[model samples]
Target: MSTREEILFELGITPRWKLRDVAEIESSEETSSSEDLHKGAISSNASGDWSELKTTIESCDRCKLCESRKKVVVGVGDPAANWLFIGEGPGAEEDERGEPFVGRAGQLLDNMLLAMRLNRRENVYIANVVKCRPPGNRNPEPDEVDACSSFLDQQIDLIAPQVIVLLGKVAAHRVIGGDGTLASYRGVEHRYKNISTVVTYHPAYLLRNQLDKAKAWKDLCFAMDLMDKKIEQRK
Candidate 1:
């Protein structure tokens, strides 16, 4: 505590707060308030209460990425999807369409799903580790990714999919603990809160590399196999 900071603290100025710091403080306050407001003893109510949270994210100013967004790109796919796909974030087509995976990459994904007897929009639900697009399709900044993570958590809670397939290094990094190598992480099963999760190469990566599609296919097959096993075990 410098003399100036001490005095400012007494005056409640926080004059030293940078734009980023001020934004973070405001975000913290808002989160605290929301937690208090949603403090029901029942876990079901807390688990189910995300409509308001989603709306708040739609108009969020918590990060600089929000400034460039055309639409919120909340998420897409069946709310009750047995298989959930988590990716890095929205790409150009996703941003333009306000849904995840709608470009050439998306086409490849569609074909891959169709082969597995799954439909992109009907059978499977898709979300991103992030809800916003990075500028120039670059990777999300760490701070930006952190800021939007709770939204993904909420999506996972609402869906409660039997298996989660994390596509690409980014989603895998968040969902599966590792040294951040897709090669190392893919095809392995991990626990995400409660659901079974596997990491896979993104469809976009498959489109670019082509060869990796074989590997991606294998990962998807593993996910489906596990899903079936779970069902059989339950029965």
Candidate 2:
């Protein structure tokens, strides 16, 4: 069996299905070369310097979230990563640590990255839709998201990842700009700023709904497939 089939078997997804053709993605008019998008994103931002961006995020008071947050989770991992993972927002632990996904959910995410043969220290970068933690880990308000959206956009432009994986409904909604349910977005190809994108359950959600782990694995497999094809195209 092929690697894809093996992964499907291990994940308990019977009768392995074929991934969507890379050609379809290539043919899409919305698709642009990753290099072009990267350049476009950098140019669009007034100050593309990483340090300056972090400083801006640090001093940002566009929303009331800054008042309650202990530290702004600026994001962590390789500055020039190929895989960008975007989560909803920071939780308590993340707020305290000033990093994204450093709690129990973060541990699971690390395992997920290992499964994909990637890691935080390698070709992977992680960030959140909202940098500050909600008062009580609640969903970030729309106004708060609007306040922080440009920073996230700057991060995406700077990283220029080959594929973007949206971790939950909020990220899916924020990046992909849709009101659709998470279920509707999963197992399908999406795009953000002309880059290939995938959606999957958040590790925190998977922790609560253990049964969905298999589905999440499938989503990872799909993302891996997309990454492979993108890499192949670059060759």
Candidate 3:
């Protein structure tokens, strides 16, 4: 199969000609002393400290999510990635695996990353607004998001990514902070911690609404342009 076809097959999506035309895309903390982190004491020096952060998340009880979760999906990928993708929260597969995006949705995400010439293990990082899987894979409550805010914040500081792609409404609401629909947030550049941010449907959503994959592709193109501009500004 052709490279493009292979990607579509992996995504389990059929090629949309317009999307094909735009075929471009775009795509932590550390603990500290446990007490310090639990008390919301983020160490400035803790930026890029993955080990400490992982320890904290594993034992986190900041919200009810920790109560039922099998494992904490701390996040995965390059510590100092240029691209950061944030999602809502972990699901059953992710909770069991202790990693984010390992199910079919994750497979689609991988294909999406591949389309953008990025990879989770490369200069890209993937995380969620909340570390633990919500019971029944439901949307995380505001308090749950509030509980994990500091951890996610520390991750942003540590990664210092030039561009962030919020992979659904929950992430957009948590990161960008407004009562906006996912469509309203798309096609525009938002800022979080001064990092350029783009919003798009989550891979899981895309799987359910295949027709929207074209829209997702367009969002990705916008994100790619944002990333390109950021790179240019650095130069």
Candidate 4:
């Protein structure tokens, strides 16, 4: 298959071909036990702090993805950043490198952040709803999401970001909790633990449908504007 075909396949879009075409596509744990594990862990680890949270993620075996991951992608960028970017999970490349958003999709995300005059190492941090890659790049299951939700919550508490950009369906579904489409989630600032949240297309999705980059840009700008408001409120 060619590069175009591969991308289409990855996105699960059917390809047009000469008698042949194809495309395909495609957590956490908790305290020992809790209804909202991450929520609880966020409070408990508040005192344990960032290092404890990172160590927990790195050594986590709350879910089966841990069995297969080469290295757990904890997160990256400013620990105290005002901007936080959360995606679905680590992809193959991310799993290999033990970092989130470091592949083709990552490059696009970097460009998007640069457009906002931000970079991961400075004013922004990047992470995933799930730390480990789902086998075969598939969407993470509910059990997996539940298992890993606490780690994410802990990360959020530590960073205390002013605005959260939830990229793609999984992040939206996990954080926002709805059956609505991604369109429904966009253009509105929802609240997750009282922090402003904006939903947007994942960079991987933008890689396939370049047209949506405009919409994603709008989402990013909205997030930036919200962050500005949050900063002013603090002052």
TM-score of each: 0.77, 0.81, 0.84, 0.79
lDDT of 1 by residue, 1-235 (tens): 2332232232223444443233443454556532222121112211465578678878888888888988778887767667788889898878888888889888667766654556777647788887888989998878888898888887888777778889888888777755478988876688999788998888778767865655676677678667766765654
Best by TM-score: 3
Better of 1 and 3 by lDDT: 3
Model 4, stretches more than 4 Å misplaced? 1-48
TM-score of 3: 0.84
**Candidate 2 lDDT tens digits, 126-214:** 99999999998999999999999999999999988878999999999999987899999999999888888999999899778867867
Candidate 4 accuracy as TM-score:
0.79
Report RMSD (Å) for each prediction in the order shown.
21.8, 7.6, 9.4, 13.5
Residues 116-167 of candidate 4: C-alpha lDDT, one tens digit per residue: 5567797578999999999999999999999999889888888887678999
Ranking by TM-score: 3, 2, 4, 1
**Please, what are the lDDT tens digits per residue for candidate 3 over residues 1-235?**
2375577555545455454342322110232332221121211222556888889878999898878999899999877777889999999999999999999999889888876666789778899999999988899999999999999998988888778999999999999888788889998998887878999999999989988887787787678767656555645
Q: Count the backbone clashes (under 3 Å) in each candidate.
A: 0, 0, 3, 8
Q: Among all windows of ten consecutive residues in candidate 2, which has the lowest summed lDDT?
A: 37-46
